[model samples]
Target chain A: MAVHQRQTVPQAADRLMPSGAAHHEQVVARQRRGRIWAIVFQAAMLAGIVALCALLLNILNQSFGYVAIVNTIDPAELAVDGVPLNELPKENLVEILEANISAGLMRRYEHDIPFAERSRENVHDLILERVVEPQVQATWGLFDSIFARDSVFAEADERFPGSDVYFRSWLTTSFISKSQSSEPLRAGVRTAIFGSLWVVAITILFSFPIGVGAAIYLEEYAHKERLLNRLIQTNINNLAGVPSIIYGMLGLAIFVRILELFTSGAFLGIGDQSTANGRTIISAGLTLGLLILPLIIINGQEAIRAVPNSLRQAGFGLGATHWQVIWHHVLPSAMPGVLTGTILAVSRAIGETAPLVVVGASTFIALDPSGPFSKFTVLPIQIYQWTSRPQDEFRNLAAAAILVLLILLLSLNASAVLLRNRFDRSRAIA
Target chain B: MSRSAPIAQAAISAESMQGPVAGAESTSESVLGGGPPLDLSRKPRVAESLIQGFLFLCGAISILTTLGIVYVLGRESLLFFANEEVNLLKFFGGTEWQPAIGRFGIWPLVTATFMASLIAMAVALPMGLCIAIYLSEYAPQRTRSVLKPILEVLAGIPTVVYGYFALTFMTPLLRGIFGRDIVEIYNTASAGIVIGILVIPLVSSMSEDALSAVPNALRQASYGLGATRLETAVRIVLPAALSGVAAAFIVAISRAIGETMIVAIAAGAGPNFTFSPFRAAETMTGHIVRISGGDLSYDSIDYNSIFAIGLLLFLLTLSLNVLSQWIVRRFREEYE
Candidate 1:
C-alpha cells in the first residue's frame, strides 16, 4: 500500500504541473474566453436594464411635448357677449355644445346622461370634444421640444398655418377626472380608472376568500395520498400557466351569453335597459377573477404550507379541533403572506388587457360606470385603443395612461414586497 | 429561542390543556349567572362541519372553473362545426385566412403566431440564459436583490404599453435600420422584439431559479479542478439545469403565443402566410381581438369563427403548460 501511494503521489504531482509553454498558453486562452463570457453575461443583464429604461423614457417622451392643435370650429366664432371662448363662463360652454352638436346627438346625450345634472366642467369637456374638436397637426418629441423650442414652434407655424403650439402634458388632474372622448385633447381616463377599480375590487372579493379556503383545504385538511387531492393540486398548477385570453373566451360564452340576465343587471333591475348588456363590468370582473384565481390559490397554498406544523400540533394537543387550530394558530401566521399574494394577484388583474378585450370592453364610452352592470372599459383597454388611433395626440394620451398604469402596478408590487419583508421578519423572530 | 419560551412553557402547563373549554365555561357562567354552561364542544361541531364544507366547496370551485372552461369551449366549437360552410379539412389545411369573405382557413393565423413566437424566442433565449447565468453565478447578493426586482418591473409593465413602445419606438428604429420600403409600418419584427423584451424577465427569473438550484458542491469541485467560473457555469451548472431551462423555454413560448395587445396593436390586422418577419401579419390572438372588437351579430359565422380559434389556442397553450409542468416535476424529482 505504501509503494502504491508513493507512485500515485508522483503521478498526481506530474499531472498538476504544466509540462511546457504550449500548455501554459492553452490555459491562458481558456481563461481569456472565460473572462469574455463573464463580460457577455454582465452585458446581457445590462441589456435588460437598458430595455426597461428605454421603455419608460420612450413613453415619457411622448406623454409631454409640443403639439400643434387646429380646432375644427374656430373658438373666435363661438364668443359669447364679446368674451373670448377660452374665457367664457361654464353656462356659455353648455350653450356652445347645444348649438354646435346635431339635435339627434344632443337628445341622445341627454338620454344617456342628463345634461342638466352634469357639472359645468362636464359641459366644458363636452364642448371641447364635440364643438372645437381640436386635432393635433404636428408633434415633437420631448428632446426637440426642450432643445429646439424655437425651431419646433417655427416648424409648427410653417406646417400648420394659424394653429396654436403648446407644450401639453396629457397627464393631469383633469385627465383623471373626465371620461373618454373621440377628440384626443378632451379625452380622459376617469371612466377607465373607475372601471379598473370596480373590476379589481370585484376580483379581490371573489378570489380572496375562495382562494384562501382552497389553500387551507389543500394544505391542512386534504390527505396528500388521495387521488382526488392530487388531481386537484395538479389541475391548479396547470391552470396557473393557462394563457389569460382563454379565460376571456370563457367569460364571453358564460358570463356574457349563458348568464346574460344576471351579468346585464336585468335580474338586479338597476342597469340602463336601453344600452345595458352582458358586456358589463360584472363580466369583465368575473373573468379577471377567474384569470387570477389559480395564481392566488397557488400563492396561498405556499404561504399556508410555510406555517410551522408544530404550531398546529400544539393547538391539537391542547384539545383544539382541526378547524379551531387552523383558524386561531395557522391563519394569523399566514395572513401577511396571503395578503402579499392577494396584492400580487390584484396587480396582475389590473394590468391584464387581453381577457378584457375578449370580453368586449368598450372602445369609446363617455359615461362613468355607475354599477357592475354598466358598460365599461379599463386602463389597459383605453391605452390599447388610444395607441391604435391614427392621430399622434392619442398616442400621447396612451403614454400618459401607461404612466398611471405603471404607477399603480409598481405601488401594488412595492406593498407586496413590504408585506413579504414583514412576514419574513416575524418568521425570523418566531 | 427566547421568543418561543412562553409558548413552550404554556405547552407544559395543565391549565393550558383545558384552556379553551374552561375559559368558555367561565365566560358562559358569568354571562348567564344562574344558567348551565353552554355546550362548547357541540357548538363547535356544527360550526366545524359547516366550515369544512365551505372550504371543500371553495376547493371545488377551481375544478368547476376548469370544467366550465372546457364545457363552454366545447359547446361553442361544436356549434361552429355545425355550420355547413366550415369544412374540417379546409380549416386545418387551407393557407388563406379571409374570414370576412367567408374563407375560414386558419393556417395563415397559425403561421403568423408561430413565426412571431420563433422570433421572440430567438431574442429571448440567449439573453435570458446569459442574465440567468450572471444572476446565479456572478452577481453579489445585493446586486441580485436590486436587479431581480428591476427585471420584474419589466415583466409587470402591461402588454398594451409594450404595444405602444413597439409601434412608436421599435418600429421607427427598425425602419431606420431596414429602410422604409422593407419594414412595414406594422411589421411583426417590432412586435416580436418587444414581446421578447417582455419575456426576458420571465425567462431570466425562472432560469435563475433553476441554475441556483444546482448544488454548490458541483461548482466548488469544478473550481478545485482548476476550472474558471464561467467554464464551470457553462459546462457543469447549465447541463445540470437543462430540464428546468427547457421548461422555462416552453412556458415562455406559450406566453409569447398567447400574447395579444402587442400583436393586435403593432402587427397589422391582416392574416398573411409569409416567412418574412418584416411583413405585417396577424396572429391567432390578434385575429380573435379584431373579430371580437367589431360589432357582429350574436349567431353570425364570424362570431362562431372566433370560438373555433379560441378552442385551438386553448388546446395549444394547455398542452404546452402540461408539458412544462411535467418537465418541472421530473426535474424536481431528479434533483431533490
Candidate 2:
C-alpha cells in the first residue's frame, strides 16, 4: 500500500525522471572511473610478474652462450708422436704433468693423490688442468649469442683473437658433477650442492619434530589464559619476525664461540678437532633451524586448527585418551598441511645466505661437506661469492648457480602447494 | 595437586582445575567443548603426561632463541662500547664509519639503511596496496590461484639471486636510463629497487588477507548506493582494513631494512653517507657481511661493532613487529 501511494504521488514522478537521467549519467561516469582504476590495479599486479620475469630472464640470459675459450697451451701442441694428451696412459699423462709444471707442484700433486692410484680419466683431467688450461677470455650471453651471432663472433675476434668462439652452455653436465675451480669454465657447484643438502638435512632434523611438538602443545594442551602459554605464543610470533641475521649472531656466539667443542665434534673425538673452530655445517644448520622454527610452529598450528573437532570428539567418545585422539585423528588429518608448511620452511632455509654467512659458510670450500662438522658452502653462498667478483665470466657462473638454486626452490615449493591442494581436496570430499 | 599446569603446578589430570575444555583449535564451523568433561578421578596416561611435557619444552625453545639473540647482541655491543677506541655517543654521532681509523660514527651506515629502505617503501607500499586490492576485489578465482604460487616463487627467490639481478640487470638498466657516469657501477638505486620487489609479495599477501577478512556487506552496501567497485575498494573496504594495511606497510619497511645481500652486493663498498640513490653506500647489513666475512679476531672492535649494529637491527625489527601487533589488536574492525 505504501509503495502504491508513493508511486501515485505527482512529486515522486518529478523526482524520478530527473534523478533517473542524472543517476544513469553518474553510473556511466563511475563505471568508467572504476574501469580505469581496475587497469591501474592490474598494472600494479603485473609489476610483480614483470619483476620476476625480468629477474629470471636476466639470469637465463647470462647462464648460457658463446665463450672465447683460450687454451694456455694448445692441445695440438701436447700431442707427442701421434698420441693425443688425453689418449696417453695415466703414467704418460703424469709424465706430461711433471714435465710441464714445477717438480715441487708435481710432488704436491703426488702427495695429494698418487699417480698409480689415480684413474686414467683423472690423470687426463689433471693434465688438462696443469697443461692445456682452456680459460674463458670473453663471453656473450644467451641473448647476444642467438640474436646477434655475427656481432658476438666479430667481438670475440676483435677482443680475443685466436680464442675458440665455441657455443657453451655454462650449466653443462660437468658443471653439476665437477668440484669448484678458480677457472670459471671448470668451477662447478658439486661441493656446494653437497653442503646445501647437509645443511638442509640438519635443518629439517632439528626443526620438524620440535616445531610440531610446539604446535601440539599450543593447540591441544595449553591453557588459553595461562601466562606461560601466552608468553610462548607471543615469543614465537616475535621470533618469526626477528631478523635472521640476529639468529646468525646468536649462532656465532652460542654455537661457534660458546659451544665450539660440541659443534666441532671435538667433544666426540671425531672430525679434525685441531683445525675446527666451530664454524661448520652444524652451526649453519642450527642457525637456520632456529630461523625457521617459528615459521614451522605457526604453520603447524594453522594445520592443527584445520582439523575438525568432531573427529576429536569421536575419539574421546570412544574413551580414547587425549594423546591417542591427537595421534590417530588430529595428527593424521593435519600431516599434509604440516608437511606443506615444513617444505616451505625448508625452501626458505635453503635459499637463505645471510645467517649462514654469519655462521661462516666458506665461499670457496672445495671439498664436499662430508659430515655435520665439515666446512660448507651452500649454493646461495657460492652464488654470492661468484657474483661479487668483478668479472663478467664469474657473473655467468653465478647465473648458472642461481638457475640451480631456483630449480631446487621451485620443486620444493611446488610440492608444498601440491600438498596443500591435496589436503584441501580431501577436506572438501570429507 | 596441580603442578605443571603453570610450570610449578603439578596436576595428575592437567585439566582437572580448569572448566569444560574449550579448545581454541576448533574451526568456526564446529564449536568445541560441547561434550561433558572427563571424569576427574580417571587414571592419567603416562605417555600423555610425558608428551605434554615434551611439547612444552619444545615451545620454550623459541623463548630461548630470543634470549640467546638478546644476550649475544647485548654482550657484544657492550664490549664494543667498552673499547677505548669506541664510545657510545661517538658511535651514534660520528658520520664517518671507517673503523680502521677509529672513527665509529654509525650515521653513514644508518642513513644509508634509512635511504635504501625509504626507496624500497616508496616502491613497495603503493604497489603492494594495489596488488592487495586487485587480488582481493577484482581477480577471478583462476587468476588468484595461478598468481598465488607465482608470488610464492617471487618471494622465495634467494636474496643473493636478487643481488645478482640488481648488480647485473638492474644496475645496467639504470645506467642506461640515467647515464653511466651519473650512476655508479654499484649504486643504492638498484639494490633498493630490488629489495622493494622482494618485499612486494610480503606486503601484498598480508594485505590481501586483511582485505579478504572484511565482511562482504560493506562492498554490497556500497554497490547498492551506486558506487563502482573501485570506489567501494577505496572508500569502504580499504578503510575497513586500514589498520591491517598499515601493519603490512610497517612490516614491509622492516623487512627491507633488514635485507642484506642485495644491498651488500649492489649498494657498493665503503660506508658512504650519501642521499643520492645513484651513488654507492653501505648499509649496516652490508657492512656486517663485509666485515665479518673476513677473519676478525673475536674481541676486536671491528668484530664487536657488527654486534652493535646487529643489536640495533634486532631492536628495530622487534619493536616494529610488536607495534604491528598492537595496531592490529587496537584498531581491527570486528565484523559479525
Candidate 3:
C-alpha cells in the first residue's frame, strides 16, 4: 500500500505540473477561442432576433403600400351635363349600373339592398363598383413608396400613365368590415374572421371540460400502478406529440364522411342544405379541439399535481368525502393554472392551419359563416390562399390578414403567459 | 406527515380526543354516530360512482383518438392499395406521382420531404444550439425575460403567416441572391428555410431547458479547474445534457417534416424526385393539402392516394416521437 501511494503521488504531481510557458500559452489560446465562440453564440441569438424582426418588417412592408388604380370606363364619361359620377342622381346612377353590368348581377345587387331604399351615394358607389371597375395596375412596397417616391411615380408614369396612385393601408377598418372580393382592390377579411371566431369558439367549448376532467382523473383518482392509468398516461403523451395534419385526416374521415349527417346538422333538421354535407364549422372546430385536447390534459395534470396535498387533507379532516374534498380544495387552487393551460391551448388552435387545410376549409369563401353548420374559411386559410395567387396585390391583402392573425394570437399568448406568472406569484405568497 | 390517513386511522385518532367520561367502546360508538352506527361497508351513491366513471372516460378519449386515426388510416390505405392503379410494389419502388398518368410511386414525394427536412435541420440545429447555450449559460435576467417572450411570440405566429413569408419575402430574396434562373419562385429552399425559422423557437426553448437542468456544481467544478465558461458549457454541461438535447433535435426534425402550409404554398405543386434544394418539389404534407384542398372527387385515386400518404406520414412521425420519448427515458441523467 505504501509503494502504491508513493507512486500515485509522483504521477499526480507530474500531471498537475506541466511545462510553464507551454501550459500558459495553451491556456491563453483556449481563452481566446472561448471569447470568440461566446461572441459567435451571442451572434446566433441575435440572428434569431434579427429573423423575427425581419419577418415582422416584411409583413409590415407589404401591408401598407401604394397602388396604381386604372378605371376601365372613366366616371367622367358617365357624367351628365358636366356633373361628376358621385354627383349624379340616384336613379341615374342605378340606371347606369343596370345598363353596364349583367342582368343577374344587377338583380343580385338590388336584392342585397333594394334600389329604391339605397341612398344616392350608395347607388353611385355601386355604379363605380360594378362598372367603372378601378383595377389596380401596379403595386409598390411601402419602403419604395416612402424612400423612392420619385422612382415610384416615374415607374407608374412609364407603365400606367392614366392610373392614379393612392397610398393605401390594407389593414383599415373597412378592410375588417368588408367581405372578400375577387378584385384585390376590394378584398377584406370579414368573412374569414367570422369563420375563425366560430371555429375557435367551438374548439374551446368542446375541449375545456373534457380536458379538465381528464386531468382530474389522472392526477386525483388514478393510482400510479394501475395498468389502465399507465396506458392512458402514455397514450396522452404520444397523442400530444402527433403531427396536427394527421388529426385533419381523422376529422375528414370521421366528422366529414362517417358522421356527415350529424356534423352537417341534418340530423338536427337545421342543416345548411347548400353545403349538403359535412365540411362545416363544427367539423373544423371538433378537429382542432381534438388536436389541442392532449395539450390541455397534460397542462392540467401538472397544475393539479402542483396543488399541496395538505389542502386536500384539510378538506378530508372535516369528514369531507373524496369528491367533496377535491371539489372544495383541489379544484379551486388549480383553476387558475387550468385556465392558463386552456388559454394557451386556445391560442395554439387559433393559429393552427395545416389541419384545417386537410379538413377542407374553403379557400375562396365569400360568405360569412352564420352557424356551426355553415361552410367556413378561416383567417389562416385566407392568407394561405391569397399568398398562392399570382397577383402581387393579393399578396398585400395576405400581409394585412397576417397582421390581424398575429394580433389575435399574440394577445392570447400574452394573456395566458401573464396569467401563468400571476398564478405562480399567488402560489408563492400562499 | 400523513397527508390523508385512511378513514380507520382517522377514527382511531378521533378516539384520543374523547373525554374521560367515555370508554373506548362508547368512544367508538360516538364516532360512528350511534343513531346509524356509521356503516363500515360504505356504498357509493349512483351519482358519485357515475361522476368518477365519467372522469375516467374523459381521460380515455385519447385512446379513442389514436384508435380512430389508426382505423381510418389503415382502412383507407387498404382500399387505396387495393385500387388497380396503385400497385403495392410500385408504390414503394417507382419515383413518379402523377395520378393522371396512373403513376403513384411515393419516392418523389418522399425524396422531396427528405430534402426539405434536411435543409431545415441544417438551419435549425446549429442556430438552435447556439441560442440555447447563450441563453442558458450567459444571458442576464433582463435579456432572458425579453428574449424568451419574443421567442414565444415568434413561435405563436401562425404557420400560414410563415408560408406567406416564404412565398413573398424569402423566395424573392433567394431569387435575387441566386439569380432568377437558378432559383424558382416556388422552390424548396425557401420553404425549408422558413420552416427552419418557424421551429427555431421550439428547438431553442427545449434545448435551453435541458441545458439549464444540468447541475451548477458541474460548472463550478470545471471553473475550479480553470476552464472558461464556453469550455464548461460545451465540454461539461452539454455532454451531461446530451440526451435531452438529442430529444429536442428529434422533435424539431419531426416538426419540420410535418410542416404543411409553408411547403404547400411555396415548395411548388408538382412532385419531382430531385436532390437539389434550389428546384421546385412537392413534399408529402404539401401533396396531401393540395389534393384535399381542391374539389377532389370522392373515392378517386387522388382522394385515396392522400390517405396512403397520410398513413405513411403518421407512421414516420409516430416512430420519431416514440424514439425521442425512448431516448429521454433510457438515457436521461438524473441530477441531484
Q: Give lDDT per model, in order.
A: 0.85, 0.87, 0.87
Residues A1-430 of candidate 3 have per-residue lDDT tens digits of 0222323345457665553456567767887898999999999999999999999999999999889999999888998778888877777888788888899988887789888998987787677777898999889889998999999999999999999898988899978988989988778899999999999999999999999999999988887778999999999998988889999999999999999999999998896787678899999999999999999999999999888776766555556656776788889999989999899899889889989988888877788887999999998888888888899999999999999998998788778879888988988897
User: What is the overall TM-score of model 3 with all chains considered together?
Assistant: 0.93
Every candidate's DockQ is 0.43, 0.41, 0.47
CA displacement after TM-score superposition, residue A216 of candidate 3 (Å): 0.9
Binned by DockQ into CAPRI classes (incorrect, acceptable, medium, high), candidate 3 is: acceptable
| Alpha-carbon shift of residue B228 in model 3 (angstroms) | 0.9
Q: Which 10 consecutive positions of candidate 3 chain B have the poorest summed lDDT?
A: B18-27
Estimate, for each residue in A131-240, the C-alpha lDDT of model 2 and write its tens digit: 88888888888989899999998998998889999888888889989899898878999999999999999999999999999999899988889998999999999898
Task: Write down the TM-score of every candidate.
Answer: 0.89, 0.91, 0.93
| DockQ preference between candidates 2 and 3, better one | 3
- Colliding residue pairs in candidate 1: none
The 10-residue segment of model 2 chain B with minimum total lDDT is B3-12
Candidate that beats the other on DockQ, 1 or 3, i.e. the better one? 3
Q: Using lDDT as the measure, name the better of candidate 1 and candidate 2.
A: 2
Q: Per-residue alpha-carbon lDDT of model 3 for B83-176, expressed as tens digits?
A: 8778889999999999889998999999999899988999999999999999999999899988998888888888988888888889999999
Where is model 1 more than 4 Å wrong at Cα? A1-12, A71-134, B1-44, B331-336
State how far residue B277 of model 3 sits from its true place (Å). 0.7
List per-model TM-scores for chain B. Answer: 0.87, 0.87, 0.91
